[model samples]
Target chain A: MFLPGRRLSLVLGTALAVGAFAWFFASGERNIPDTEGGLDGNGQAGVFAAAAGAALVSGLVLSSLTNALRLPGKPLEIGLDGLNGATYLQALSGLVAEVSRSWRRQIQQYFSG
Target chain B: MAVLVSDYFIPAIFALVLFSLWFAGRDRVEREAHQRAVGISMTALGIANLAVQVINSVYFRPRPFVQYELDLLFYRPTDSSFPANPAALTFAIATGVWGGNRRVGAALYALAVLYGLSRVYAGVFYPSDILAGAAIGVVVALLVSKLFLLLEPLPTIVLRLARRLYLA
Candidate 1:
């Protein structure tokens, strides 16, 4: 639920991913022996081609999640009709109240550390 | 004074960033403009990445460290290397996503550049591969974003085509 600046997210995500890839490769243990001396032309080609396929599927999955069950804040649903200052302020205040009620402790933990 | 920034690490870092952007592009977009801009841009670059990779199926360009036996601190790509797909995708997504909120755009660009740097520092890809790929990505994304802007309020034409193409 953390919404970092998009740039930070991209950087952190890339760092995390590269680190994870290293971890996986180091721990995979399956190809180490065969690949140590270096994969032959065809073997290397196969490994990358296979990995590209996996990357494609993974990319698709990241963009298309169903938001039906997500925490609601549908901007489209909240059109400007009757959306004046009082009602909007009330709504925001209510949101703060609800969050404080549920996630106050988590927020405290996040900052206090 | 080029102490590091060898071939292998740079490309590896770029690859990592590309993968991350692809991951973000797939997430549920709160705003359609941001979503479509990022989505089409990254996906296209990603596909371009795949195409370059296919060429690697034959190219097998050696890493600089490997050629010089420098033993840099990074993992080597098993596949052939040319036209670094990862670098291409990272810059492409950054430019594509730049049309978003100003804060968001600046952040994405900075992140993309960092990712690019990490690749060179990692000793994974050649400078040329990274540069060329990044340039292509940025140019294409700019064009694509412009087209999306011109076609906003996504008409029946786009939605219908998207559906028929199974992209929607």
Candidate 2:
């Protein structure tokens, strides 16, 4: 429901996808302790935070990628459960248009009155 | 695999799975329901951690690596080992999500079980410790969910405010 435009989703998703793997590899290589007492409480917290971030990033990337890779020639119809970037953009654009029209009408009425 | 999973992989995946539930559902109503579940799970996780800490303070149990001769795959944790914190945290989240979304909750439960097993395999936690942790997590989640229900409109009001900010 909080989907962004296709282009934005693609870019962000790709970045997040790369970031997730990169973080896992980099952190695993450096922070995983081979010796006892190597990881303190703060270090453990950092690892957990990094893991959470990576996971969230990966999930978002997958969701956005799934929607982006849909057939390009197909109609941009919002499905009943279409909770992707495109649908979010569609809804956002609709909201903006509605708000602008209402504002324009209000202004026009104020001037006439 | 045990080392990597025990260290961070499972927790990472668990967070991913839990958050995915928030993005699920066909409409706002469905999404809101999932969001509520996420909120409850997160809250339960926090409380579960606190509960584990309290237990640790009350009773000190040495880690498996300290007492038994086994190839340890994880770092030596300084905390008390009577209740596995990872197991408890994961189970709390799984149980919390289960009340609203069963499928995702089931996946979370599987992951939680895997996490617990990996910790044991890695020579960090005892099977009994993991069991105790899981029990603590499940009981806390159930209690917290019940409390939320008893609180009624308060939780709903908070969610409404979150919705106003486009959070829910």
Which parts of model 1 are misplaced by more than 4 Å? Answer: A1-113, B1-30, B54-60, B146-168
Estimate, for each residue in B13-84, the C-alpha lDDT of model 1 and write its tens digit.
Answer: 434443334234323343434445545655556555665666678777776666766555555565544666
Q: Mark the 10 consecutive residues where model 1 chain A has the least summed lDDT.
A: A77-86
On residues A10-75, what C-alpha lDDT tens digit does candidate 1 reach at each position? Answer: 677557676866685555332232357655423543565577668655643442232223424322
TM-score of chain A of each: 0.38, 0.35
Model 2: lDDT of residue B6 = 51
Instruction: Give the least accurate 10-residue stretch of model 2 chain A, judged by summed lDDT.
Output: A71-80
Q: Residue A92 in model 2: shift from native, Å?
A: 11
Off by over 4 Å in 2: A1-15, A26-113
Give the CA lDDT, 0 to 100, for residue B26 in model 1: 28
Which pairs of residues collide in candidate 2?
A: none
Best by TM-score: 2
Candidate 2 C-alpha lDDT tens digits along B1-168: 653555556666666666556656767777777888887888888899889989999999999889989987766677789898888888999998998888888988998998888888888899999999999999999999998999989999888765432334
